[model samples]
Target: MMGERILPGSYFQYPPPGFPSVSPHRPSSIPTDLERVYIRGKGSVKDSVKEEKLKDKPGFEHLNEPLHVLVEAELPKDVINSRLDYVVAILENLLKPVDESLDNYKKQQLRELALLNGTLREESPRMSPTMSPSMSPFNGTGMKRANYFSQKPLI
Candidate 1:
């Protein structure tokens, strides 16, 4: 089964370039506090040494200090409700122009539809008699009649 290998031995032995290799010195024991552990970015060994030196400096040392709690003052319910009402009034004022434009568009559409119906009604009487199959010249005739030519050919 090893002879018919789907992957080569070198694939398991070495990782691809730009990736970090597995550390040989990794401890078998697990740490109790995961939150205290700080993870470092994928950087060079020289960069890690430089960071350690910077941490030892007095100016950069304050970053290691514990964070302070921030206290916020509670807002009154009346002030919050007043702000919401002002926002709603502003939104309604903004939408008034849009509502007016939409109303004008709807009126224009109704006027156009009325004009179209008026034209159709005026043209209907002239179209109705011509459109019927029984009113056609060829309806009673057994032979097909050529309406365009004056005389029928001796075919």
Candidate 2:
């Protein structure tokens, strides 16, 4: 009876204003948050009015873990020294004689320098190549004349 009341041609007319007859759903790959909302026949509407839409969403908190550089393989050892005991011994043998010779030469040179500079008395017992003739114990007055003892009278 109701179908007979409405004209058959009226059934094919467009849906009432602000209502869609059938709506097609979007695929899952599309994100819900977008700058524009699209309709099939009409291009799109600006989504600037969505500030309130996001007000109820949860806020994100920062995680506490430290950031680090990525590495592909294990690091190599960083040892700083060589381990041969003979190297130390060889160094000792090579170094000791030179150091000893240097010290001995320094002492001898300092002694000779002191004698040359006259800090040492000329009468001091040290004999040197540049010592004066009078300074030597082997010189004229330094040697005693052979003592002639009168044990018996000379003829």
Candidate 3:
């Protein structure tokens, strides 16, 4: 026969009265029905001292469900870390655009291209008799024909 020792209730689960530091030995000022009807009268009064005192009591409206508990139960460490990073990234994105730093670079590149295209179009009309098919910058430039036609002014 395996004689196993049984643990006390206090060993596993601590009740309100068990934890003296948390549970108050004294009674609360939230009056009983008779006390409210007779002693306190019709109108209710706020007892700040009692309210503050009650807040320190055990089971003083402490939520059973905490976010950390859920996170620990459902998600692994790596998954949690990844999700945390993703949330941080999303928050950063919402606060600022995704391509914020690249905006200036993109704008500068666009400006440079516009200048190059403008110069090319301007120089296209001034082609002399010496300018051959190979000499033409527009010919076989690999740029789309539509881009040249759209930007190129009719002579």
Best candidate (score: TM-score): 3
Candidate 3: what lDDT? 0.34
- Tens-digit lDDT string for candidate 3 (3-93): 1111122321332322211112222222222111111111111465664565546754322221110111124544545544444343233
Quote the positional error of residue 87 for candidate 2 in Å. Answer: 8.4
> Pairing residues by index, what is the TM-score of model 3?
0.17
The estimated TM-scores of all candidates read 0.15, 0.16, 0.17
Query: What is the Cα-based lDDT of residue 80 in candidate 1?
Result: 42
* Each prediction's whole-model lDDT (CA): 0.35, 0.32, 0.34
Which candidate's lDDT is highest?
1
lDDT of 2 by residue, 33-151 (tens): 21111221111112424433433445311111121111111122331112122223332232233343355443554566677677854445666758777867777767566667844
For candidate 2, the C-alpha RMSD (Å) to the true structure equals 45.0
Number of backbone-clashing residue pairs for each candidate, in the order shown = 0, 0, 0
TM-score, ranked from best to worst? 3, 2, 1
Comparing candidate 1 with candidate 2, which one achieves the higher lDDT?
Answer: 1
Q: Summarize candidate 1's per-residue lDDT along 35-65 as a digit string, tens digits.
A: 1112222231236567566765666553344
After superposing candidate 1 on the true structure, give the runs of residues whose Cα lies further than 4 Å from its correct spot.
Answer: 1-75, 98-155
